[model samples]
Target: MNGDWLAEGRAELAAERILDAVRMLFVEKGASAVGMAEVAETAGCSRATLYRYFDNRQALYVAFAGREARQLIERVWLNRSINSEAGRADQLLDAIASVLAEVRKTPHLAVWFEPANSGIVAQLSNSSDVIDAIGAGFVAGYRPALTDSAARLLGQWMIRVVVSLLTLPGGGEDEERAMLRNFVMPFLLDDTTTIE
Candidate 1:
């Protein structure tokens, strides 16, 4: 039995505890309501210790959110959207759908991405590995000339649009997906696709 395993396990457990505290506070109150002190208190760590792990509240929230986005983009979106040999345009639309589908299912994550939170999140966005991936996914093969601003607009728009769809009280899944497809294709589908 390797004692190194026990050391690594303790590190993992502490990281998870901190993240759990962040999630609980941010969910119960908006991201604005949670601060480093609150997180430290909830996580059973001293403020100095929490700061040792994460520099600040925005750092903690952004890091956690970015990590979640990366996993969702890779596991759920990339896996579901990109076929073995798909072109970039098809991959882009499918990736958009996959991300929105995830946001629809996980509203709490959506809260962290809200415009109200954007002032802080936007600052952290400059360093986001996940947003970088999402942006790169948009720029690849589909539209090499696409501007970064447009990609950002489209990404946030997709999330807002999907939230509207899910808030509709009641609707059949097929019908909703079809409705989403019809509404989204014009803007998101490749300009090369002929609309009938």
Candidate 2:
């Protein structure tokens, strides 16, 4: 048991180091340009060693995106703020807007939404169960009355909206807020709920 634990720890550490190398390359060259061999060299590990951890470049990209997504979720969740006067609909809108602002501020993450890379990032996010679950949790927390299926669907839609905004931001914060409020809030929250 002790040996197994130690091996697992070592393995996780190696993978983390590899991911750190990848982050540097991503910031320098953009995510699309990174390759496994370049990552291996940057990590000071053999290609064989890198491949053992991640089967290919796509796997590595997914792993990195997954890690960043988790961090982004945590950061947004931790800093979530809802005014007492704000209704449930307003609260949900706030959460969605918060995610967009945070990602834009985070350079490492924001790069994924660059014009050249946005499509790929969107595809990865759609396919990632982790990303979907985070979105679902956000919706379920706000709307406990929703059925599982309904919450899941809403969550997927919320994530897509975030991706869309990231890929192509509105003219300004006012425009973005209007888009969310006028278009998304109605579908997400009942008419009985107050906007403020």
Candidate 3:
């Protein structure tokens, strides 16, 4: 009751609504079709209020992608039990499949994840600090033997491959994922090691 709980509560609600609207907008319209006003209206707030939270469309877009990536990775990590499941490629595969499949469902997010989606949203690709943070989070627990660049590149490539699968003409998720484990496993994960 002491910390201006009323204002804080209102602010939290507004932020959540705006973020949710932004995410939905991204899913429905990609980057070009949606604007701050649309996002504000979708959030059921005024554009002036939305601007108070985010400086510009790009910043909100970045926040939206960042939030999505965090949630996706958290889900994957929880499902795979990545911390406790040691040396289990199958579990890792399950986790990755879930993440990719979910991402594939969101066309705008998926499109942005691709290198080519750079045209839609700047932060979805290499230009995004949010993505870099996500990459850092992924590599944080990785074995020290794998250089930072290697770990980041491996993760980025895996994401790209799956996104490509989603947008590509024919190949299915299973095939691409299977091929990934086959070729990339040697460098990133050892067979006998258990992560969980």
Candidate 4:
């Protein structure tokens, strides 16, 4: 049992090291341009070894994206600045804005948001269950009244909004906020919901 545990720990460490290499590549090159051979070379592992850890480049990207998404979600969860006491509409808006801010703050993740690469990232996000679940969690955080399916649908919409902004940002932060308020908030929030 101890040997098995040790083996698992070692495997996890190796995977993390590989992911770290991939992240550095993402920072150096655009996310859409990174390849598996480059990652394996950067990671100082043979192709077979890299393949053992990640079946293909897409799989590797998914793994890396999942890690980054979870980190972003955790950071948002721990953020003290997010006004939990605000109305549900405000809270949802804040949460979505926070996600954009966090992604922008990390250059490695921000590379994926660039216009040239945003389409690839958006496609990957659409297929990523991890991102969907995180979005659902974000929605459910502020609006517990929503059913799981409703929250997920709202979450998916929120993801689309984020991707749209990342691909084509507004005039400025204020403009972005206005876009969210006028365009997004009304559609997501009910008429009875008050925005404070």
Per-residue lDDT of model 1, residues 1-196, tens digit only: 1223235448667666788888788778777678888887888877777776788776787678776667676766555533344464455556555666676567566665565665655555566656665755643434444566655555555544554554442366566656656677556656463223
Candidate 3 whole-model C-alpha lDDT, 0 to 1? 0.64
Against the true structure, what is every candidate's RMSD?
Answer: 6.7, 4.7, 5.6, 4.6
Candidate 1: minimum summed lDDT over ten consecutive residues — where? 1-10
lDDT of each: 0.62, 0.79, 0.64, 0.79
Whichever of 3 and 4 has more TM-score, that candidate is 4
The TM-score obtained by model 3 is 0.71
Worst 10 residues of 4 by lDDT: 1-10
- Which of the two candidates, 2 or 3, achieves a greater lDDT against the reference? 2
User: What is the alpha-carbon RMSD of candidate 1 to the true structure?
Assistant: 6.7
TM-score of 2: 0.85
Error of 4 at 182 (Å): 1.5
Q: lDDT tens digits, residues 79-187, model 3?
A: 4445554655666666666776777676756756544455554335545666765664564454445566765665565555555554452477667677757865554
The local lDDT score (0 to 100) that residue 13 gets in candidate 2 is: 82
Query: What local lDDT does model 1 show for residue 21?
Result: 82
Candidate 2 per-residue lDDT, tens place, 44-135, comes to 78888889899988788878877887888787764664435457667767777888999888777777889988767877877777777777
